[model samples]
Target chain A: MSKEWIGKTSNKVKNTVDRLLVKRFAESIGDLHPIFVDETYGEKSKYGVNIAPPTFPRVFDYGVLEGVDLPMKGLIHGEETYQYERPLLVGEEVYCYTIIQDYYERKGKSGDMGFVVIKRVGEDAKGNIIFTEIQNVIITEAVRKGINV
Target chain B: MKTMTEFKPGETLKVTLAPVSRLDLIKYAGASGDFNPIHTIDEEAKKAGLPGIIAHGMWTMGNLGKLFTPFLEKGFIKEYKVRFAGMVFLDDVLTLKAELAETSGNDLFFNVKAVKEKGQEVVKGSVHFRLYDAV
Candidate 1:
């Protein structure tokens, strides 16, 4: 039996909260919401600084797994869940830690495969949990002959 | 500011996502720890029966973030959920449309759908955002 690989990622460091980072992200994604780019416009709204979109966490959280390796092919994204404790603010230094929450294998139309769950928690400068996310990854063995797994 | 309670059901909004590239996929993979070869390697994607290197499902869902910009201070987004229905190849013009399905007090409910240029539904699901006083 192949041993299931499990591990944790290191913390990612962010020093200054650059509003431009948010703008660049929004622009790259073709987002035109004034709240994410125009600080003057955002100030007039509820959030004082430019508020990042919900998926913005994707830009910060994945850094935790900087140098890890899980050598396998044919990986599929099964699902994702994110919960926010508070809205992230600009200029707030934050860090994140990632861990393998669970792993299991089963037989399906795809074939005998394994699923790995990863969780990452984001914290503020004060060490408060601001957000948490979990990602499910499916790994399947290589198919043989013309038979599809 | 308009509260979700003010909008009726079946109201739809069209939102588009910018073009994605191989570099963007690599950047997202580094940030999300989802180094799935299908998204980063064209060869792998071809072998998997995909047109080419494709974007991540979350990356596509991230387009919905634009909709919430108009309604910030609503406590950010509380929850966003979706299911991957199809593949999004590189350089594909993607559009996300959401219909206001229901609303209660400060919370707005939406049945979200994403599609490629060919009008194929790539993802479908619901998302809920909490609204706050506009002031």
Candidate 2:
């Protein structure tokens, strides 16, 4: 993995937080939290409406970066972390983008592997950051082997 | 499940999810844009020396993340972090247990973990969140 990819930014993705989409995201995780599901419960709560889960941004479709491309076939999600400025509320349109934060290689018990650290940020219409996620992925030769197998 | 007002320091909450199935893996693949064969194709996984289709680490992390949902308001989580402690295979039943680590005025912190049958730990981390006053 070339560290040159570090600092490369991906295309931006925009989305309006739809209640149904939030519901679907929660359903996918089998989490039926009242604030994410029950409208009446939401009305009585602080936000006064449904909200998406912290990890819901995982569903945002961020197409591949223009100049930074890693082997897509054999990538493994190694670790993930998230920090939030505020909750992603239902009905607020959000814009998100990703950057290759860092890159490196290490030899592990499995074999030689490449690591790519990606930082994804989401901001509201006014440009106030709503959340940020840092995801690290590992690329292995076995990924290519599995494809041919 | 513990509420912001009701949760006391040192208390533990347990959340058990539905078994991780092939369908769940597929849906997650579609939803997360992580279509790695290791999570969806059995032959590829076996070729890679995996038992079969293994669940995504993020899926297990998401399972652990859900435990804090009921206790705090939306977007109140200041920070969340998790490490992939182990692999989860198809049909593995995951149990998540979270314990309150500390609490301040309106901030709540918890230590959470996900485990499979026989107490094999899969994921473990801490979540720091802020509580909002209910009107």
Give the C-alpha interface root-mean-square deviation per candidate.
3.0, 1.5
Docking class of 1: acceptable
A1-149 per-residue lDDT for model 1 (tens digits): 22333565556665444576666666645565787777787778666676776777766644545444545555677777777776777656678778777767788886687677888778876888887888777777553212232
Query: Which whole-number lDDT from 0 to 100 does residue A39 have in model 1?
Result: 73
Query: Which pairs of residues collide in model 1?
Result: A17-A91, A62-B31, A110-A149
lDDT of 2 by residue, A5-96 (tens): 88998877887777877887777677878888788988888888878887888877555688665665557777889999888888888988
What DockQ does model 1 achieve? 0.43
Best by lDDT: 2
- RMSD, one per candidate, in order: 4.7, 3.2
Q: What is the lDDT of candidate 2?
A: 0.80
TM-score of each: 0.77, 0.88
Backbone clash pairs for candidate 2 read A87-B75
